[model samples]
Target: MKLEIVRSCIFGFLLVIVQYSLAQEKPNIILLYADDISARELPIYGSTVWSLPKGGDTSDRQYRAQTPVLDHLAEEGIYVKTAWAATICSPSRAMMMTGRYAHQHKWWHNSDKGKAPNKKGSWNLYDSAPYTLEDIAHKGGYATYWAGKTQMKISGFNFDEACFTPGEGSYNTPIATTDFRLETRKINGQKKIFNADTNQEATSYVQSGWYWKPHVQLLNHPKATGPLEWWPNNKAAKDTFGLNTFGPDVELEFIFDFMERKQQEKKPFFVYHTSHLGHDAMDFLNPESKSKWPGTPKISWDGKTYTRIQPNVTGDNGVYDTHGTITESGIHHHINYLDYQVWRYMNKLKEMGIANNTIFIFCADNGTSGYGKGSPVSQKGTHVPLIIYAPGMNMTKKGLQDILVNMSDMLPTIAEIASVKIPDSYEVNGESLLPFLTTDKPKHREWIYGYHKDMQIIRGDFVLKDGKNDWWDVSENPDDLISFKKIKDWRAVSEAHRKERDELNKVLPRFNLHATAHDAPKNGLEKPTPLQLIEDNK
Candidate 1:
C-alpha cells in the first residue's frame, strides 16, 4: 500500500510537468494593429517626408515623429523592409484576419464588397473564409480578446471578448453638461456635421467623438451584464465619464484587466489591439483649429520612462480649454502617443512575469490617409510598417530584414504561434512565417501582392506593377517617397527586370474576380466557401 501511494504521487508530478511544457509552447500573442499609418510615419522606416501640423508639403524635418519604443523594438527584433496590405482599412483588415485576398474573403475595398442573398445584403468575412484568426486562437486553447477600432463585422467572428471604440455600435449618450461629440444631422436631405464654433459644414464624416469624451462598447466583458453592452455602465466607470476621457486610454484599461485575469487563470491570451491612433478625425475639441486629427493627451518620454499627463480640458458643447495639456494635432503626435502606449504594453508584460513568453507584433492597416489610404500608387497605399519581437524565439534574421511580407501572412503566423494547424484542404494564400522565423531561412517570400478595387498590384525584387497597370523598375531604393523608374517599354529594361515583370503579370490573373465596375462580385452571385473554392480550383 505504501509503494502504490509513492507511484501515484510520481505520476501526478509527471502530468503537471507535461502540462507546463505544453503551456510554454503556446506563447501569448499581442497583435498591435494601428490604423491608417504608413511605414515612414514611424521613425524606424527612415523617411524624411512628414505631414505638417495642419496641412502642407511633406518636406518638414520638424514634423517628424519621435518613436524611441519602436526604434528599440526594431533594434531588438526585426522590421520588414517592405510589407503590403490593401489600399484601405476594411479589405486590409479582412486580409489580416482571413489570410486571403479579395478573391477568397471578398472584402474588395471600403465601399466595394461581394453581395449575398440574405438580409445582411453584403457577404460577410466568415461567409467565404474557413476560419478567422480569433477562431483559430480559440481552437488552439487561447483566450481571444479584440480591442479598439473594429472595421469588420464582429457578429460573425469568434472573439472571446472585445472592448470597442466608436463604430461597433451606437455612440454613448451625452450628459449635455460634460460631453463633446461630432454630432450629425440631416439638413436639406444630406448628411452633414455643422461645426458649432465655425457655424459651417465640417469636412469630416459626421460621427460621435472617438478622442475626447469618446464612445465605447464592451462585449462579453467581465464587468458587463450581457453579451453586448455600452461601457461606463458600471458604477466606477460612470463617475469617471467626462470630457477628459480618451478612448484609447479606456481601451488599454480594459485590455490590461483582461490580461491580468487570463494570466491568473493560466490561459494563454491573443490580443488583437486594432488601435485607432493614426486615423484622422474631425477635431470637435478644437473645431476652429482646422486640425485633421484631434490632439491626444500629452506624454513626455525622457529616454527611459514615459509620463502620460491626464488631460485637463474643461468645457462642453464645442467650446473648451486645453490648458496646454493636449498635444497639437499631427500624424507625428499620433505616432508619439502610440510609442507611449507601446511602453505601457511592454511594462505590463514584464510586471506579469510573462514577458519572455509573449510575442508582440506592431503593424498598421493601410497607408496614412492623405498620402496613401485608398490610392493604388507605387507602394504608397499598401506599404506599412511590420515589427516583431518574440523573446526566446530563435530568429534567423534580427533587425531590418529586406523581405517581402503581406497582411494576409498574419493569420497563418498567429495560427502557427498558437500551435494550431490549418487544414491542407482549406485554401490559404498566406505562408506561415514560423519556419523562417525559427530556422536559418535566408529569405521569406519572392513576391508580395495587393489590390485596390479592380486594379491588381504585384511586386517582385526587380519589378512592380501598380494599380494603374503601370510597370516600374524597383531594383534600387529611391531617395524620395516614391521614385521608381516607370518603364514605358519593357523591351528597353534588362532581361531580369523583364522576367520579373512577366512573372508578376502572370500572378494577377489568379487573384482577379472579374467583378463589376461597382466592385461587387459579378452578377451578385454568392461566393463559394473556402473549401469549395479550393476544390473547384483543384
Candidate 2:
C-alpha cells in the first residue's frame, strides 16, 4: 500500500511539471496599432513624401518621419510591402477585430453602419462576429489587456482590463478636473466648440484633448472603485494629473504594470495597444500654431536611454506659454514619440526576461488624415505599414516582404498564435499568417481587398481596381508610392497582368453585397446577415 501511494504521488508531480512547461511555451503577444498613419509615413517604406512639422499639402512641404526603432524592427523581422485597410477608422478597426470585411461586419464607413434587428441602433461588430480577438485569447488561456484608443463603442469591449481607454464619459461630459480641453456646447440654437480654458470660441481644436491632460478612463484596475470609472480617482493618478501629464505615457506605465503582474502569475498575455499617435489633432499646448497635429513633449534618445523633457506649460483662456518644452507641432513629432514608445516596450519586455518570448506587431488604421484618409484613389487611403517580429518562433521571412496583406488578417493571425481554432460556423475572410511567417511558405496572399462605402477595391500582384472602378498597372514602383500607371485597355496589357486581373475579378464578386446603396433596412437584411443594403432614392 505504501509503494502504490508513492507511485501515484510521483505521477501527479510529473503531470504538473508537463502542464507548466506547456504553459510557458505560449508566447506573449503585443499588437501595437497606430491611428491614421499611411505606409509612406514610416521611413522603412522609402516614400519620398511625408508631412511637414507644421501642416500643409503633401506636395508643398517635405518632412520625413524619424522611426529608428520601427526601422530596426522591420529590418530584423519582416515588413509587408503592401498592406490594406479601409479608407477610414471605424471599418478598419472592425476588420482587424473580426477578420472580416465591411460586408461581413456591416461597418462600411465611419457614418454608415448596419442597423440592429432587435434594437433601435447600429449593429456592433460583437453582434456580427461569433467571437472577438479577446474571446479567442481567453479560450487559448491568455489574459487580454487593451490600452490607448478605444474607437469602438465602449460597451462592446470584451478585454479583461483596460487603461487610459476612452469611454462614454469622454463624449458625454467634460473632465472637470483639468483645464486643458475643448468642449462643444449649445450656444443659442447652434452647437459650438468652446475653449475650456478660456470658455470662449476657439479655432485651434474644438474637441476633448487626447494629447496633453487627456481625458482618461480605467477599467478593472486594481485601484478602481468600480468596473469602469474615470481615472485620477486614485491618489497617485490624481496627484500626477496636471498640465504635464501626457496620456500616452500614462498608458505605457499601466501596460508595464500589467505585464509584471501577469508575469508573476505565470500567465501569457495579449496586449492590444491602439496608440493615438499617428492621428492629427489640434495643438492645445501651442494654440497659435497652424499645424494639424499637435506636438509631443520633447524626448531625446542617446542610444541607451531616452530622456523626456517634462512639459512646462502655464496659461488659460486662449493664452499660454509652453516654455520651449514642447516639440514643434507635426505628424513627424508624433511618429518620433511613437518610436520612443516602441523602445520603451522593448525595454520592458527585456526587463521581464520575456523579450525573446514575445511576438510584436505594428500596423495602423487607414491612412494619414490630410494626405489619404478618405481618398480611395490608387492605394492612398488603404495602404498602411505592417511589421511583425516573433523572436521566439522560427519565422522564415525577414526584412521587406513584397506580398499583399490586409488588416483583416490580424484577428486570425493572433487567434492562431493563441492556439485557438475559430468555430467552423463563423466565416473569416482573412487567412492566418502564422504558417506563412513561421514556415517556408513562399507567398502570403495572391491579392488584397478594401472598400470605401459602396465602392469595391481589389488588387492583385500586377493589377489593381480602385474604388472608382479604374484599373492600374501596379507591377512597378512609382516615384510617388501611390501613383501607378493607369490601364486604359485590358487587351493592351501583358498576359500576366490579364491573368491576375481575371483572378482578382473573380475574388470581388464573392464579397460584393451590391452595396452601391448603404441603407441597412431597405435591403431586407437583419443583424449579422450577409445581405447588402439598398438606398432609398425617394
Taking all chains together, each candidate's TM-score versus the true structure is 0.89, 0.90
1-538 in candidate 1: lDDT tens per residue?
Answer: 7666556545643443344346554689999999998887877877767676665447777688899998998879899989999999999999998999998767788888877535356777776675888877886778999999887677988899998886464532443222344446579898777654346676666566667777788899886789888768877888988878998998998899999999989999999999999998878788777767788999998989999888898876667898999988998889898899999999999999988889999999998888888989888889999999987564656889898999999998887666566767677899877656655555678899998888888899989899998888889888655678999987889999988887877888788883633334444434433321111222
- Report the error of model 2 at residue 43, Å: 0.8
Candidate 2 residue pairs that clash: 198-317
Q: Tell me the deviation in Å of residue 299 in model 2.
A: 1.5
Give per-residue CA lDDT, model 2, range 455-510, as digits (tens). 88989899999999999999998866887899998888899999998888888877
Candidate 1 Cα outliers beyond 4 Å, as residue runs: 1-25, 171-179, 188-191, 194-201, 516-538
TM-score of 1: 0.89
